[model samples]
Target: MQSGHNAMTGFVTVILALVIVIVGLVSRWPLWVWPFAAGVLSTGAAASLVRARRRRPLIPPERLLEPELPIPQVERWECVIKDVSLPSLSEDYDFQFSATVRWLPQEAPPNAPVVNAGGLAIDAVVDRARRITHQSPPHRSSLVQHRLNGELATMVADPSGRVLAMADNVRLTLADADRERLEKLATVRKNEEVWEHERKWEQSKRAYLGEDVLRTPGSAVVWWLAKNDEKIDKTVSDIGLLAELSSAANDQSVPDDFQRYVPGLAKEQEPLEAMADESTTGPPSPDEYARFLLRHSGLPDGDPRRALYLERVAEAAKGAGLPDVADALLRMLGDFPHPPQSAGPAEPPFDGYFDEDPPYDD
Candidate 1:
């Protein structure tokens, strides 16, 4: 508007200047007046020309067809599926899953069939998680949940490509009862391992005793000396007892080499001459048999060793189911006399002798 007004004012000024020039000429004005008029006409013309050059030409009205509408955009939506039950590798056990899911519907051609976008998104996310959970044990739900979180954090195009789905804050859980059962099972497995190891140790110990340490009286003595190097005398004294224990453990009689150390043992091994005598008036009674065995023990009357021998024989008779003979021998042992005080402190009885009886009676 301003440029057009300036152009009109300049045109008016030029017209006025031209009229003055023409009137001055027709009226025969002074030459100075003509120069002034010429200057005015020049100024007006210059202004008009400058204004016309600065003015912008009108732009034709743009074609007014309605603005083309942007293709309607499909907005992404969010759906949360919580407490969904999923199967696990363990029988009768299921995983509980929950997640916040976001998805976008795929661009479809016109006349496309209607579909459930939210349902498809949920199914896609759940199915993707199930693929992992189904292969995992119920007790490993936390680990599987971690894996699912990483996988579902990124958007994935569904198999049908109808929608893109992603998930966050994923969770998986197992029943408390199942978790407890797994813990107990693990404990039992560990206990079973311990028991197996203990059993093996016990068997090894038995084999060592039977096959190595106690194989014979000599081996037994060697083993005892190795353990008690300073107890040599004690070891020698206990050799007979060790032999007896070893024989008992192996279910055998004492070795002949050791029989002399155990009084009454050699006599027991020999057949009774009185029993074989055809002229014998009758079989000896328990008392007579006990006295005969005592006499053959080779330990003299009033000797502490004799009492020890009697005690051992009684124990053996009792073990052999001869209760009457055992009783008779015990009575004889109780009646056995002790040596005079002048004998001094009697030598300590050997390990196998006088186990329950005093070396001397008071």
Candidate 2:
């Protein structure tokens, strides 16, 4: 647009100049049509300039990328397993999931062991997203978590099923099967958590003194999602893998009464289920949970009381919904060391709000 406007302006200026010259030359060529001569010169110059500008393409013409051909509608023929041939990527068996399938979930690696959708075995290879079904498990919902564990030879169409390519990422997914597993595991996990929380003080104090960690499920997926704690010092991280867990959970829709019907799960972590939906920022633990605490504390870098604030001040941040406060307090230990004189217990764990970030209301 700018170029065209400049061209038009230049053309008009040339014409004006020609008119002036013609008027000046009229005195010399009294009988000649000076205006005609001026018009011709201006028209020629403007035409040539406009033509030249159009010949140059704006941005380089991009090569035409081939679009994928639509998949043929299979007539649904039952080809009995005369010889069932599945897709395999490497003869030496090196699984490569370098890139993830765009349609498949990118939250976790598309591996069988990770998802186990619909209760399929760990060795299942997902060729494509087939169908999702909600069958009840033997006692509850029929949930099987399935994931792929190897590089997949993807079927790219060339009119016929002749050309197959190994995509950088496998299309591993957890359909209804996987979701069922996650929900069930979550219930069992909740049960374990409640058991542990009932005795976390005993567990942590003992571990702090000498005994080994009480060894709960660690619920890696739970923390991976809602870890507002410091990732630097935390054992788990946002970058870590929960594709296995997430894929399984996402594959199926949670039962309408998932929380209610899920016997032990929703019961165990009532605070978490009630406080917030699972996110990439769950609670923190002892190991590296402290580091995550530092990041969320919003204190100045290297605050002297940060450790004490986390360890001593934030202990007040606890109640029915706080399963991960330990890491928060420990991370902010340097900020608030000693609690207020009349803030309840003097040597309490951490002293401020439980459901919210610290400093306190009263």
Candidate 3:
């Protein structure tokens, strides 16, 4: 409107300038009048040129006929939710969560229903975090918090798609007392597992010894041989003691075949005259006692029992600080016969002991 008014005024001024020039020529006006007319004409021409340059171009009818794009309407806001308590996997335990939530409402039509974007954002972020915390124990709140920070760091649209929300600086925690209790409980559970393992090991050991190794004198001999195959001589010498120990453990008497090897059995059957002779001699030497015991046992010189009885006397001599007597008895054992070979298949190398039922009834 201003540009048009300026153009009209300039046109009128130009016409007046033309009339003045014509009148000056026709009526013999003064030279000053011509300069005034010329000045007026130049001013009008400048005004018209300014208006024409400033004018906007006209739009084509087809351009106006095209459809116009709708402008998007987005509402963005932020809020801080503090001390939000959420349940955890454990009963009587909850996670305390706090974070800054930023929300961006999705673009909708002008007639779309309006909703509380801030509340939706808070609910979406809190609910998403709650799902993770609910599956995690109270003691693992820090770990769960780390996971939430990663998951909620990005904007995620709500289920209804009305708003997108994101969380930052997420903090999940448990009460001091609850955290301490959980730590102690974890320690206790770990110790319980160790204790259970040790208890099982002890039970297995007892079963192996009671039912397999020491079930009988013969079984004890075989088990000892499996363990100390290189010490065959020593095993043969300890056979008497092993048989005695096995019998005592089972609350049974030593087998008759092994009675001669056991000192307790041989001593009970010794004659009074022999005891008197030992009294008369004050006390027999270790070698003499070994020979006497072997004779009373009725075991032959090459019998393993002879070596076993001699070894027992040798151990007694050593305990009594008689090295010379012990050496003599050991030399006697060396002269004894080697153990008989088995006619059956050779036993496998001993890896470890295992439990099994005893061969005989209790």
* Leading candidate by TM-score: 3
lDDT of 2 by residue, 78-97 (tens): 11111112222212211211
Model 1 root-mean-square deviation: 19.5
**Model 3 TM-score, all chains together:** 0.53
What's the lDDT for candidate 3? 0.81
Worst 10 residues of 2 by lDDT: 76-85
lDDT of 1 at 131: 90
Q: Report, for every candidate in turn, its global Cα lDDT versus the true structure.
A: 0.81, 0.41, 0.81
lDDT: worst 10-residue window of model 1 = 57-66
lDDT of 1 by residue, 153-235 (tens): 99888877888999988988887887899889889999999999999999999999999998888888899989889989999
Q: What is the lDDT of residue 296 in candidate 2?
A: 48
TM-score of each: 0.50, 0.20, 0.53
Residue 292 alpha-carbon offset, candidate 1, angstroms: 12
| Deviation from native of the Cα of residue 360 in model 2, angstroms | 98
C-alpha displacement of 293 in model 2, angstroms? Answer: 67
Clashes of each: 0, 73, 0
| Pairs of residues clashing in candidate 3 | none
What candidate 2 gets wrong by more than 4 Å, as runs, is: 1-17, 25-29, 32-164, 167-178, 200-362
* Candidate 1 off by > 4 Å: 1-74, 109-112, 262-362
